[model samples]
Target: MTAPKANAMKKTTKPAGAVRPKLAQEGFFGRSGYFFARALANLRQNVFVSVVTVGTISLALLIAALFLLVYVNLEGLANGWSDKVQITAYFDKEPAPLAVAALKTTVKSIPGTKSVTFISKQEAESRLRARLKGQESLLEGVNADVLPASLEIRLDREHRDNFAVTHYVAALKKVQGIGEVQYGEEWVQRFNTFMNFFRLMGLLLGSFLTIAVLFIVSNTIKLTIYARKEELELLSLVGATRFFIKAPFLIEGVLQGALGALLSLLALAGCYFAFLHNAGSFLGVNPAGAGLSFLSPLHLAVILGGGVLLGFIGSLTSLRRFVNV
Candidate 1:
């Protein structure tokens, strides 16, 4: 070869000895620039696929959040109902005033007793009369003595559940003068059962929903990543590190997860407001009075973090499996 031709060859060719120095001079950004740039370019090229994946993930998260919202509100309502739980003990006959006073003190000594009010036969008769105000004729022949004197037992705020109330009732029955105990046992049991069922449903539904979310969203992510399978394979062939190959995908996953979670939260907020606005018409009670609330701060954080994590995992793990990179 002539001198000019040899010089041209030397300029055109990169020596093995100079490659490391060249890469070192470029530093971190230089070494990863094309991989990062191309990754971004691929994302731009596949906007439709990216959007579909985000939409799928958002819908899944929205559903889970909605369930949580309902569960929280229902739990609040159940707690309110539990708070109203009362146990009433009826006496066979009207006790003497002193006897009633002694009995009230004895009942008050029970562990969970908050307050005990003695209703004399006359007071009980008066209550019945007040209840039947519009039908006074029904009480024409009724006598005050017919109504049994009773102790109206209101339990402590924390111990109003059926079990506590039953235990209190047993303690009351053990009192010498106290008679039969009637505390709407069936109602309390049913309410507790319903509340328990609601909690259980929340657990089961949440589990199933999470599994469903992972399954469906994973498949969507798979398709999105699979669309760039050939590109990823080419990058691998060119000796790109796995980290570099996966960076763009990880970024895409995090973005999708975050955006989807935000949108779902927005949707949930809209639902909450809509429910509150129309609640009075259907339920006849103001939700404001009942103290309905949204998720706590911790819950919100968990959701946001969960979204980002879900996206990251989906990108990192699924990308590898989908493209076999």
Candidate 2:
């Protein structure tokens, strides 16, 4: 009898692991479909609260995403402008052509320097004429001989920081025949300061918004659990496993969060399109030339993942307290 009992125990335990793989291979689509249907039924049962919770989440996510989008674009613009940042070292007088070439080689060899191009006095004069556009008469007395022959230096991205650039400028100014090293000092400094401020603000705002959404979702889920307390008690009395009892609520939470994220994305897209259609030129963002990207595919994936995580957490929190009670 003992041997048979032990054999039967092994038979039961062996199928447990094997059954899990088979069930998993069956895929989640059927389970997900059932969960979605149950979630919709729950939402319909608690229409007012569900709408309020979803609306709150949507508004919060939309605002956060908008700010994030703005921050990303601003950072990209700043990086682009920084890459174009070059130091023009003007010569005190017209140096020999060979000397200019030597100076260009020296500048190119400097640490952090990506490229150095020699700007001849004649080229500089022509550029000035083009810039002035029909005001060439004003530069009639300005001869190429007097115009400075400079070396325009491009720095690598790693050395694009203001302090590094400033130190490089100081060193470059000591080079022979180089009189003044000019760059957008004030503009770069101002941009760095502004970007820092925006980053701090984004952090604070994102934190507060995340907390607010979490609280709202958790409370909503709590109320939902409370409403179905009697049914849950009945399930518990019937010896239903905890997993079975909690599965539906967890699924509902995930559905709520995912739906809210998707709705928010749609609403933001609509707003963006409307703005572009009406005020594309006014906004200074070209409609045709690299139109605004709302979110990258990676960011969209993160949003969906975040929604599912938040939903799961809220459901778990609510169920924990309600089940214990």
Candidate 3:
């Protein structure tokens, strides 16, 4: 009996060194791997729910991306038009090269001025002729000197507002070489009004769309959680912490968002390519000349981030509503 008891003790008393490998294997990374595997299994087992969730996310992101593309392009076009709304200050006389150079420097030194380009009389005439198109023959007897040499001053973004432009015009009139200042006051005011309205509408519309997407994603994710009710209940019964129970769902949400965003991007690229291919006939300009542009990398990143956040929030909201944990 003593010998038998000793053997039993030896069998039960494994060395500390022998137990360490098991502990190490079940550390943070190991647990994370388990959660990851479980999440993937959940996704695979509920194929219909996963597809529906992904599809819903993809559709939402697509709509968002389309609106984003429109907003970006409209903003770009508005900025371009604003840059073209220059202040043309005519020179009283044909100044020497040094005088022209000095005037250019002076114009550039102004606080709101983006750039100053001196347009010689000849270049001005050429521009007029180009504008005239076939009517240029009507000006056969007109002298080039009738046109004025001017400094075209483009304003910086902050200074493109009506009040700023008015102030800049007043300041330019006081400069020594400026014979006359010309800018369309009414036109500037109208442009500013349109820009303000455009921005306001974009903001309201974007907010509505974003909320709609969030709701759709939340509902879709709720379905996914409902499908895994048994698994979640079993985990909870087994003393799994709330964070541990919720983490896999959060990861699933993020995965859905990331994949959805990628799908949207790919779809957008296809549309862009299609647009380029058909742009000439539809828009009267080829892609190169159409002034169409895709979103910048920074903008794309923002879209991806927005999708991820939307997913995370949707998942959190759904879980709170449905799972009780």
Candidate 4:
């Protein structure tokens, strides 16, 4: 009788930890499947609200993306333009060819100067004629000797801002036989100031738009929670864990955000193509010359990631109230 009693006790205890492993396995699989099904059902049930929420997010993301694209291309264009921007230092008269070559070498040695090319008097005259094509007769009397030989100095990118390049050029004012250093100093200064103002405005607008998006998403999620309050309460009263309750809604939010991002990207692509077709000529972006590139795969990934993060954050914020209650 004692041996039988001990055997029965061991039998009962044997299933305790053994059952836990099986239950844990079942729980993981069961919860995952339930979460997926619930998320799909929720999306279908709240189709109208989902659409509105997605559309709003899409629009906001689209505007932000467009600005980002513009900013990237503008930076590229500015860098290209900087390389083209050069100062022409004109000599007093027709210096000897050897002296001009020596001056060119000296100017090229300057820290900011990338390249220096000497434009001879005759070449300068020819360029002037080409520029004033219709008025060639007006310049026929002037001799090549009258046109001064000049050194065209291309500066480094760092020196392209404001009067940095100008100051560097001014240092060569007393160089032998150099008459004057000419560049668009005033125009460059004004352009830099304008770019600064534009960047500041963009920053402010981006910040406001981001806040507005967060507010909209948070409110939408709160509404979703309110509509499903009864179901959540019932689940809580039962044996459903907090993670099990929240998983479905979190998945739904992610789906909404991903769809929104994809739709916005498609819309943006269409708009960009249309703009390129209609206004390519006016914009000076040649169709054949390395035309404008759309968002790369990496950028698309970033957009999708950003969308998912926003959705998760909004859902989490709304879920906090339910958790506390």
RMSD of 3: 5.2
User: For candidate 3, what is the total of clashing residue pairs?
Assistant: 0
- Candidate 3, residues 186-205, lDDT tens digits: the string is 89999999999999999999
Candidate 2 lDDT by residue in tens digits, 129-214: 89999887898888877778888888998787778888889889878889988988987677667767867887897788778767
Clashes of 2: 0
Candidate 4 clashes between residue pairs 3 or more apart in a chain or in different chains: none
lDDT of 4 by residue, 1-325 (tens): 6999989988777654555444534454666877888889988998887887788778877877787666655555555555657788988887787687788777877778888888999999899989999988899779888888888888887777776776787777768889888887776777678667766877887788778777876787778777778878888888777787788888888888888788888887888787844444677666334335576788878888877877777777777777543
lDDT of each: 0.78, 0.75, 0.82, 0.76
RMSD of each candidate relative to the true structure: 5.0, 8.6, 5.2, 6.2
Compared with the true structure, model 2 gives a TM-score of 0.75
Best-to-worst order by TM-score is 3, 4, 2, 1
Ranked by TM-score, the better of candidates 1 and 2 is 2
Best by the lDDT measure: 3
* Candidate 4 lDDT: 0.76
Local lDDT at 138 for model 1: 96
Q: Of the candidates numbered 2 and 4, which has the greater lDDT value?
A: 4
